[model samples]
Target: MEKIATREAYGRALAALGEEQPALVVLDADLSKSTKTAIFQRKFPERFFNCGVAEQNMMGVAAGLAASGKIPFCSTFAVFATGRAFDQIRQSIAYPRLNVKIAASHAGITVGEDGASHQALEDLALMRALPGMTVLVPADAVETEKAVRAALEVDGPVYLRLGRAPVPVLHGPDFIFRLGEAVCLREGKDATIIATGIMVSQALEAAQMLADEGLDVRVLDMHTIKPLDVAAVVRAALETGAIVTAEEHSIIGGLGSAVAEALGEECPVPMKRVGIKDVFGESGRPEELLEKYGLTPYHLAEAVKEVLARKQAACR
Candidate 1:
């Protein structure tokens, strides 16, 4: 399969949506080309706004546009989109439930050589904490396109986190996407691995490898971080006897925390989480960081094996 970068998918999706929806507007902080909003700027020059290196001001501008009934999508590196302008997003978008979409690029360790300063590893936690905010992290290029189209229909504030690295297409054109809904890619009873963002693909790869060792692993794409698919998570916990939650964000407040919150109240199970540890990242390539932080398919496979072993021991 030909791998395409998630940023490219955002560009094509923005261009398609810009041509179709006149009310849609895009803004960037002098990084339109890097964030992949240049495509939308090219096709819909009047609707696109380049705020020029001012992330905070760009966020404020988006809020103003949203107040005026225009659906604004603010694009920038995820760090600046949420870190620098979090207060604006909180007061302007979430407080009023404004119809604005923050399409953040270069999320997670996928920013590669740009180092930890540009990577947005904490975006999921930040966006999920905002009241009335909808957080969506697409797994790959194909899913990124679907996520962009879906963000428009959501009634309130939505944060669409995207990445820069080229990844394999996990779904075909027929995949249906919806906000707050999780997709079950593979079904199993031995153990269920719930993952979001780029880790979804890694979970799937781990499941395939584990199946060869006689462990039937279930894989779920838990894309919506906020308002997570609790029912699906609970059902998996009840059926699988164990779970492993994974993501590209910090383990404390991302998919792991959400799943633990649901399962702890409902059906508790022997479980573990795979994600970035509670520490700041350093400069490295995406693949190197993933391996260093134990975000690889090998690590996921090993985690599943360990969790299954623990569950069996408890049963005995």
Candidate 2:
């Protein structure tokens, strides 16, 4: 399987969308090369706006463009796109429900040596809190392209969480992406592993490991966090009897929290979340950071075992 960074996919998709949608415009905060929005800028130079390190101003400009009937895709690092322009995003774009797509790149601890300040472990939490905001975390290159296209079709504001590190292309060319829908990657009756973004592929790996131990593990790709697939969460809880959620973000307020919130109300089950345990990330290689932070497949497999154990103990 070929590996491609989600940011690279976003750039290519945006450039393709530009050729189709004349109303589509792009805004970047002086990180076009890193964010990969330079691809779109190169193809559609006239439609690209370089806001020069001012994320707040970029959000405002995107909102203005959206108001003028233009579909604006604001590009920047996830930390700056969400943290630096939170107020602007909430007030300017989300408040009015503008058609602005915040294509945030370099998300999660995968930003690597940039360290905690650059790593966006809480961007999903921030974006998900905004009313009418659509939060999407594509698992790989194929999903990233679909997400970029889907964001354009959606009505309101969209936040696309993209990664700096390359990940295996999990889905095939025929796979269709639907917003607020969870795709079941694997089936099992004993336990369910729900994961979003880069963790989806990791969950698949964990499923294989659990299978070797005679534990049947179901895998779910919960790519959309804001309009979470509550039905899938409830189904996994009721059918599998246990659930384990994995993400590259903090376990406190990310995909894990969203799944817990839905299941807590809909159908409570024995569950454990695999992610950063409420701690900031540090400078390191992406793979090393993932292992140190316990975001690896081994950790997810262990989480599955722990949840299943709790499930059995409760029955006993």
Clashes of each: 0, 0
Q: Ten-residue segment with the worst summed lDDT in candidate 1?
A: 112-121
- Ten consecutive residues with minimal summed lDDT in candidate 2? 247-256
| Candidate 1 residue lDDT tens string, 216-273 | 9999999888889999999998889999998988898888998999999989899999
Report lDDT per candidate: 0.89, 0.93
What's the residue-level lDDT of 89 in candidate 2?
Answer: 97
Candidate 1 has a TM-score of: 0.98
Residue pairs of candidate 2 with colliding backbone atoms: none
In terms of lDDT, the best-performing candidate is 2
Best by TM-score: 2
